[model samples]
Target: MNKDQQPVVLGKIGASHGVNGWMKITTYTDSVTGIFDYSPWLLNERGQWREVKVLRWRQQGKGVIASLESVDSREQAQILTNCEIGVLQESMQNLPEGDFYWRDLIGCEVTNTNGYNMGKVDQILETGSNDVLMVKANVKDAFGKRERMIPLVMEQFIKNVDLLEKQILVDWDPDF
Candidate 1:
């Protein structure tokens, strides 16, 4: 996506909560309440993205139910079910040092310490102990590896990450 593009989805609108027009919400942030931090959410309604404010919200059991401004009826709330809730991408909070967002690492080149160009990071998997980088390798590699699962363990596997250079240095064996 273009860096200047807005509308990074933080959550999705679920079914209407009550007759009072409250709607169930599912957030995609670190905490269930994190999505609420960015209010006046941009909701994708039909083909258009409409801005709506969170007038009130409460956590009920494991899920969240909310009431939005200008939506005061169950029918109005039902119309929003399944629509995405987004905020401008530029509005995302910053992270500390050594931290990288998944989006930034998706296209990074992976290279072993032996100087073998492993591949580009295709995806990241959150395992029980730590994260793993799924590297899609070149078809002509000596090991015939189509993909490699490199643990994102700093010092153990990952040596360095250069975001500006778009490359990852690893302590991996190319023939493995």
Candidate 2:
């Protein structure tokens, strides 16, 4: 698929709610109802992406249940169980400067302010208090570690982030 048409995974389809093809949803959005903001969801069916229209949805207690325009039977809903939901990457809203999405941070080169090549970012960790960058180091680096978890606190540790360059500069200790 074209890069612009690629869908960004956003949620997962849980078990069928009732006999009317309504299914529970587990979303990755900051707000539960925010998932509804993006319509015509690109649902992954057996690894293939198909667009599904949202008929209606509601919040029950703490969970969300939604019905698709075409799915009107329990069997149809059952077929979608465990399927992931996605939306076009372009559909996501623009984030302000200095706020990078986790997906964009993956594979970015990391360096300390002293020009030490720490490694490339492998993933991010959300530890409630702060988000962390999990950097994977070179196999034979003279440094003592394979992975480093640097907090994403901009005011202190993070010195600069150049998304265009795919690099992150931090005020970190190389030998730590």
Specify the highest-lDDT model's number. Answer: 2
7, model 2: CA deviation in Å?
Answer: 1.0
TM per candidate comes to 0.79, 0.90
Give RMSD to native, each candidate. Answer: 3.0, 1.9
How well is each residue in 99-163 modelled by candidate 1, as lDDT tens digits?
Answer: 88776788899998889999999998888699899999987878999999999998889999999
Model 1's C-alpha root-mean-square deviation from the true structure amounts to 3.0
| Candidate that would win on TM-score | 2
- lDDT for 126 in candidate 1 is 80
State model 1's lDDT. Answer: 0.88
Relative to the true structure, candidate 2 reaches a TM of 0.90
Model 2, which residues run further than 4 Å from truth?
Answer: 1-4
Model 2, residue 89: C-alpha shift (Å): 1.7
Steric collisions counted per model: 0, 0
Q: 51-94, model 2: which lDDT tens digit per residue?
A: 88998999977889999988999999999999999998778889
| Alpha carbon lDDT of each predicted model | 0.88, 0.88
